[model samples]
Target: MTFLKKHKNDILLILAVLILAGGFWLYSSFAMDKGGEAVISVDGKELCRLPLGVDTTYTIGEGEHFNSLVISGGEAWMADASCPDHICVNSGKVSLEGQSIVCLPNKTIVSIVGGEDSGLDGVAG
Candidate 1:
């Protein structure tokens, strides 16, 4: 008891440090679990950030699609795609989690970004 009384200030300091560390840990865990916002942009400038699970398509100009690319039915993709291999005709849509479609022939990569990612998609940054 005498020793504790003499070191009371030191004990209080240690307790304060522990409490601060615990609080910081809790805040970090909560921030990680909430899942940050999803943003779509080009060259760091944001283009659009739709709500989770919303389907929207962005079309390219005539020269953008391809040399002789003809899309009779809308000619636009589904904004997101969900395929095992991600190599399907309509897999170009990107609207859901872990959903992506790539056109190898055209070197086109369609991917979904933001809102709780599994940290598995290699292409996503």
Candidate 2:
């Protein structure tokens, strides 16, 4: 009882932080519009938009430089790539709007689009 009284403020602060964190988690989980299509681009040029509902594999570029993108179960990911680091392939799948997988070496970018706009165009530092 004495310990509880002594740490009352600390306990209250912890509880407040936990509550705020939980509220933010719930809002992030439930809010935001899910994307319906995955847009692929190379060298800052738009390539094509694939429907998320369709399960398929798309090969971007040709010759020694290529990236294989797989879309399945409403998610998109890089299945294979010719890039040396293979960071894009290891980045895993993305299903939410504004999420992207980029390969700097291959100059390839796969991003989710066709969702609600956040109304922000570039953040200034």
Candidate 3:
């Protein structure tokens, strides 16, 4: 009882922080829509563009230097990669605008782009 009274403010502060963080995470995940394209690149040069709303798979390179890219359910993930660390393959899915999967050893990048409203009226003529 004494401890609770003494540390009440600190405990409340921690809970408030946790709640705010979780709210931010939930908002970012659900409120933001899927991006326009998955723009893949190798060594800083664009390799291809894949629409986010479409489902597709791509083998990114040749021989031992390759990454299997999959776009499904409005998200992109590296299904497989030839990079030494395999970090790209484990990167999970990216759907929000500007998210990316980067394979440093393979010099490959898969990035998401779009989701701006473009300042146009919602109603079409």
Please give the lDDT score for candidate 2. 0.87
lDDT of 1 by residue, 29-57 (tens): 55443222234343334544444333234
The regions of model 2 sitting more than 4 angstroms off are: 1-31, 115-125
Model 3 score (lDDT): 0.85
Native RMSD of candidate 1 (Å): 15.4
lDDT of 3 by residue, 14-81 (tens): 99999999999888778765577889999999988888767899999989999999988878899988
lDDT of each: 0.43, 0.87, 0.85
What's the TM-score of every candidate structure?
0.29, 0.68, 0.67
Where does model 3 exceed 4 Å of error? 1-33, 115-125
Error of 1 at 86 (Å): 12
Worst 10 residues of 2 by lDDT: 116-125
| C-alpha positional error of residue 40 in candidate 2 after TM-score superposition, expressed in Å | 0.4
Candidate 2 lDDT over residue span 1-125, tens digit each: 99999999999999999999999878866875677789999999999989887789999999999999999888999999999999999999998877899999999999998642222212311
Best by TM-score: 2
